[model samples]
Target: MTQSLSPLKSFSPDSGQVKVWIRRLVWKMSIATFLLMAIGSATRVMNAGLACPDWPLCYGQFVPTQQMNLQVFLEWFHRLDAALIGMSAIALVGLSVWFRNVLPRWLPWASGFALFLIVFQGILGGLTVTELLRFDIVTAHLGTALFFFVTLLTIGACLSDFQGNNTANKLPWIGLTAASLIYLQSLLGGLVASQWALHQCFFRGDMCIVMNTHIIGVVPAALATLAAIVISWRTAALHPLIRTFANIALVLISSQILIGVATFKLHLQVAPLTVTHQAVGAALLGSLTLLTVFALRDRQSSGQYPASKLT
Candidate 1:
């Protein structure tokens, strides 16, 4: 008689060391992704987008030998940093694929997708500079980075060993709804940044001007996120991972709003804070996307739980 392999043995948990290494790799990639986005935003804030005035190089020099000019240095340094991050991302993809048996299947795909997007984003960045920082291309570049950020977060969550209860399946819908709203808000924020619309409502001579219309859209978005948090918390049937992510989204969204108000009240002169606001928005979007993925995963894994309820 032929022996049949047991399903239980087939789906056994990965070894502790393998899980640890996967987590470490995910963390490294996350940090690199954040740094990449931050540097790109800094380049914009410093108005160094066209300092080098060349694609993939600074003033026809591979290393930018001239360090006396601050703009040229900043622009060149940003490019160098970008190259390093790209290499790191490639390494991450290799690691994920090499350890695919122990790691989640989605992790490798996410890393590969991110790598492709980064290349595309690089092309967009080059076009932005070569075209004198055309608004459309610049905005598209930012959008692409946002996509990569969310993908990285999803991969990180998948690699984690956290498993939610089977009772939490019903809450996946809530998580999906909240994620959709957060994404929409994030896209709107990107539009605002790309269009340079933050100052649209502000008249040069008007002091104590009302920003009601400009800030109105944020209210609904914030409310939807808040509702999701409350639902996740109150629903004892929800998974802890989902609840944790929901709470984080709530906190980040609140902070983002405060930063937005501060940016407006300070007459938008605070470059660092403005960039920070953008970063927080990106982080929130990424976290929510991961939360959605985790919630769905939990629903699928719920079947592994015992059929008898634990009193």
Candidate 2:
């Protein structure tokens, strides 16, 4: 005899409480992911990428001692943060698996993918130090972290209980388009950073080489954002979430463009603005990705299958 599938269980009012707990866990993971990115960025900005001159440890020690220098400390701290975040990711995967029957398959799978990406990211981090920050490895490191951040955001959104009730499905294509462009732009930004081309446009004054290359990627990104906005605005009467995310995309893209210009015009290669610009780019990319995931998810929750899968 064939095994019978389990019957669907009746909805529990306490499901809301469970969802809230999941949302909290997702937020914690998101924060951890963001902190990892910040620490990585800080290490780069501080010129401490090669401080340890080793992989998975600092100066051949699991923990540096008081005799260790500041560079060693920075590098060790970064590793510590990475380890914490990795543990957090493992916890997320465990929770997802435990709740597999209650939660959507997408939730656990997405969390697992993020966990895998974190491991890949850790390897890339080691390679970055081992190769003395080779351009290719560094670029890959940043890009991988960006991917991880986006994955975390997706899981976070999935955990939220805010399922839209609008049966009307529209602009799924636009959301996907926006996500693709944002991801491309994020990769290009990583390339710029990895190449240390931030100063490429310094001498030109009128023409910005680094900014131009970055701007080239932005063209498609902006077009995608615009398309999403137009589509969402037209369908706003049907889905308010669409409208909200559309406006958010417009605002974030505009701010990102401004930050890019400011970073170039001011010749900002260090300190607050440089870090701020980097953070803003990360935020913009993460936000766009989240919007796209949630948009598709809203459709899915409403029993309208999205045109594409996130994976």
Candidate 3:
């Protein structure tokens, strides 16, 4: 069937409309990246990290014909999601370039860096499988994924025009501290799981050192998160989104701790709980990123960074 096209409905949107759409796209991609981390976590928890036994393919074919088992499907879908994230990064970069006049000067460079991370993430995924999920490599893989997730969040925040810089805002450094603690704790937890330390806790007490350290590290992490929440609340009048993000971070961390307890009690054998733990970790990371965006400003042209300069 042929239909006549109407030029009346084809008018281009103004810069403001384009900006809104670009911001929305970046935000959606950021969230999708977060979910992708969760899926990747589930794949690993299900012992499917090597289900494909190859990079960018399954069973030496585009699709696994020998058997479409659960493990194979998880790994296949994980790779598929990674491909989608890569595509989104490309789109984000393209949008940044096309809308350079509206976006911050650093946005294109930042998006380009995110694309680099996607490529590096792919390499890490390949190594995780080829090297039989070595503890260090597996931990590195998780770290890289988290970093990429943070990068996307940062980009989305940069594109956002909703947050205003508040001269009254204080305690900005607290967010960075909390984020660092969360990242370190997550890395240690990943290392313990990848090395099978949690599984050996009952018998190989000596191998439980990393797990024990991770548990102990929770105290400081929780305190830092709490501090962030309190600071955000106090500064809410000046910066509302910061308070909202801090509250979300608190909730995620609380859920994460509960899940950690359950995962420990169950000896990390429960796949769902394990995945939930990792997913919460990603959410917490995203929240901390919001806090960072709330706290820091863009670098000034004079090379002097000021708290108010970001907005």
Candidate 2 stretches with Cα past 4 Å from truth are 1-18, 65-73, 200-211, 238-242, 301-311
lDDT of 2 by residue, 1-311 (tens): 12343233333435555556666776776777777777777777778888887778776789768537766777788889888889888888887787677777777888788889989989988889878899889888888887888777777676665565453265666677777777777767767766667665565453356556777888888888788777767664344655666787788778878887887677666456666767777776666666676667666665433332222
Instruction: Give candidates' CA RMSD values in order.
Output: 7.0, 6.4, 5.3
Off by over 4 Å in 1: 1-19, 68-70, 99-107, 200-214, 303-311
Evaluate model 2: give its lDDT.
0.72
**Winner by TM-score:** 3
Model 3: per-residue Cα lDDT over 23-129, one tens digit each:
77777877777877888888888888888987878888887868689999989988888888889889878988987886678988998999999989999888989
TM-score of each: 0.80, 0.81, 0.88
Q: Which candidate is the best by lDDT?
A: 3
Candidate 1: worst-modelled 10 consecutive residues by lDDT:
302-311
Worst 10 residues of 2 by lDDT: 1-10
TM-score of 2: 0.81
Candidate ranking (TM-score, best to worst): 3, 2, 1
Worst 10 contiguous positions by lDDT, candidate 3: 298-307
